[model samples]
Target chain A: MKTTRRTTILLALVLLALPLAAFAASPSDAGTRWLHVRVVDRSDDGESVRVNLPLDLIASILPEIDIEPHIKDGRVTLAPEQGVQLGDLRAVWAQLRQAADGEYVRVEAGDGNVVVRKAGTLLEIDVQDGPEGAEKVRVRAPLAVLDALFSAPEGEIDLAAAITALAEAGIEDLVQVEDGESSVRIWIDDRPEAP
Target chain B: MPRPRVTLAAVLVATLLLTAGGVVVLAAAEVWRAGTFVLSVRDEGPNGARVAVVVPGIVATLAAVAIPFMLPDEAAARIRPAAPAMRALASELAGLPDAVYVAVEAPGERVLIASRGGVLVIEVDDGPDHVRLAIPLHAARRVLRSVAFAAQRTR
Candidate 1:
């Protein structure tokens, strides 16, 4: 009887710790990702702005916003005259998702250079000299976010799904723009606060 | 012997009354502590004035909780569809970690919105005029959830 009692106590302890162990394992799965944006303008009074927002909260609230005539129900319907076909985007994304990680494109014009590539789980874009003073521009996004972006129906882009994916997928430095006197950075990560 | 017994009985009665009084005071204090919310307003406009208001959060809480019974059926039905999402949003926001969500500083004014210490704070400062509003995050979540519950409880 004592042995049986000990076994029962052990079982109870394990059951009590199960949820806590799960919670500690995957934080992003719990909707704990934060999106951070920081901008510094040295040209002025050395002013800076920082914003950190919770993604799950955004995902929960996105459905209520109505951007009439274009966006509804967390999806965007591209204008016909814009000539952007959903099928084409889907096909291209499928190819990219399957392709091996490598430098895919490099364009050099008279004034600038543009490079697009897939690296590990991220799609990276590096553009230089695109804007007059923007000597370097970099953007990175997870493949999962892109996949979710195109998960909508035949004629729409699923923004809410993409955001939800972004919140779940491992996120890191996303965009950076640097110039002589100003800098802007936007990224998403599991951190609770802006850095 | 009868007089001695009477004295003992009187002592027991006094002890019981004191204990009862102590218990009542503690209960009232707990209630007050649970409902206290502080409001401070300072405006240095043309003339300077400072005022402080102490309000019991229970008033707002009670009003929110009473919505289900007080609201008309048509209105309740109209809000029921959206209640779940609002409740979910409120719940998620309450779980979010403390962070500064907005910080903007311009020439004449500054605005800051942040969640800190289990409270959501919004502050705006423009020269001599300043305003700051803070609400406990958990209290807000409770109120909002109650509102959603009310909406969903339509007949």
Candidate 2:
């Protein structure tokens, strides 16, 4: 009788835990994945524009792309359909390649791809798999106001110049720029207020 | 006290198996994809509980694909053309702004929040049978309820 009772109790406990275990095992087990993609650029004449590029980029660049919203491992993951061409990503990478220095900035370009990372620079650019194996590059800002420094042909991409242009456009909003080993961050004056 | 009699071990094992089965089923069926949410709903018949995963597509294709799996051979014969109905419904829901806190419904027939309009038409395939909701956005949800309802709803 005691053994039967114990077995019953065990079974009940297992039943109660079934859903909880599944929930815990789910990627959300850690937390929900919230992705925010911010794109800031100047239009030829230099009117500072910053907009959320997550959905828009998906629609415009990869029409057939799929976006899975989930939390995987410990970090939030936005697994976009194979390849999505993010304009800001391309622009940042182009700038990084031009600013590559022998020691600080390292450039590895092969297999129709390019990667640039500068030790002291305010940004770290990651170029990886995208839709249909296309290059999906991500430029991370390590500092609150980190800027990418690059030297492009005559009128191409210039990091310092872009910074100057941003400042001139109304960066009393920009506070500080932090450079990381992997990414760069830019802090704006209205940051604490503006996200 | 009136207490329930159930075993914890049995419960856990059963739950694990059920969850694993669900995961496997979903993966195998390729029901997992972008812009789609999986949901479990009960049937409204004497048959009691039933699981039906809903998807968006043209009505005819939906009827064709769902009839064989959701209903028996006899009932599928009664199903008729649903493409015209789905197209009308899809066209109405296509271009609404992404504003939260709105309720769109048709009295007792249906009450739902406006989710984004995708390429395919919304469908409800009750196992072995499919039924297309002919009501469009304008007719389903009254303007006042659609625009003023402050409750949150996910499409």
Candidate 3:
């Protein structure tokens, strides 16, 4: 009887272990790691722009900018988490139009840097990373232009005030723009951590 | 199968058709019932343009009716290509413990590997081959919950 009981226990253990052994032989044992992404855009004027960044960096910035990711059919799609009403955009546009004083403004990013230019006015802003962990922002424009853009009547531009205005206009709190002499520059050390 | 003569005839006919404003529609009627419908115009000067519409609908319909006869032929067989994502999932599953069960759905095929206990269903996108497997946030949350529950049960 003891021998039979021992044999039964051994048989039960073997049955339980057989599935475990089969699972151990699966191919997806090691998890995935790095991801690479590349994007290229060409304009009719023969100007081309290319951007290459890691997927992890994009995921880190999504939450900060209020973007959501949807995973379906082995792909992840990104979209704005909150929809912006037309009224909000109209309000911001009205504010910007008043500040522009009938000038055209254009913003572009390429080669790890952002550039903002205001036509008919000496307004140019360049944003990039600094030597340290701090972000570097350089602005070269007229004091009057900066003051008008920031809605500062005293001819003085405050970064905090400008950012507050933008926030009120429905912009996310991703970065704060600072005002400098003859320009505005904002620095923030909010780089996302690498996985 | 008729080489030189057929090729010369095809070229001459194509040139003649182009000059006469006649369009020659080449259609794989086996795939679509409508097939290639050609609408040609022959300008006769004072007589205006004579419009002639040639539709291969009848031929396509006949071919569709004869699909049963064509099925036995090896040439008519549909070939299903294996999806790369399914292959990757299979490779990954091969190294896991025997308790794991995996169900991988590819473009036109479904592969199931059930072993012991845990079940994992992977749905592959019909998108480009470069796209890797993406686990939905809800699914991941469910897995986390299960793991937490198991850990708590053990405790």
- Residues A52-131 of candidate 3 have per-residue lDDT tens digits of 22223223322223112333222223233445343444355456546654334444444345666553433455566433
Each candidate's DockQ: 0.21, 0.08, 0.02
Rank by lDDT, highest first. 1, 2, 3
Tell me which of candidates 1 and 2 scores higher on TM-score. Answer: 1
lDDT of 1 by residue, B1-155 (tens): 45444544555565556556666776675455335455666788889787777666556656667766787877767777667667877767556567788898766678888877656778888877777777666566777787778777736
What is candidate 2's CA lDDT for residue A190? 19
DockQ of 1: 0.21
Cα deviation of B33 in candidate 1 (Å)? 8.2
Query: In model 2 chain A, where is the ten-residue run with the lowest total lDDT?
Result: A26-35
The TM-score-based order of candidates, best leading, equals: 1, 2, 3
Model 1, runs deviating above 4 Å: A1-31, A45-47, A63-73, A81-88, A130-134, B1-36, B69-84, B149-155
* Cα-lDDT of candidate 2: 0.35
Q: What is the lDDT of residue B132 in candidate 1?
A: 76
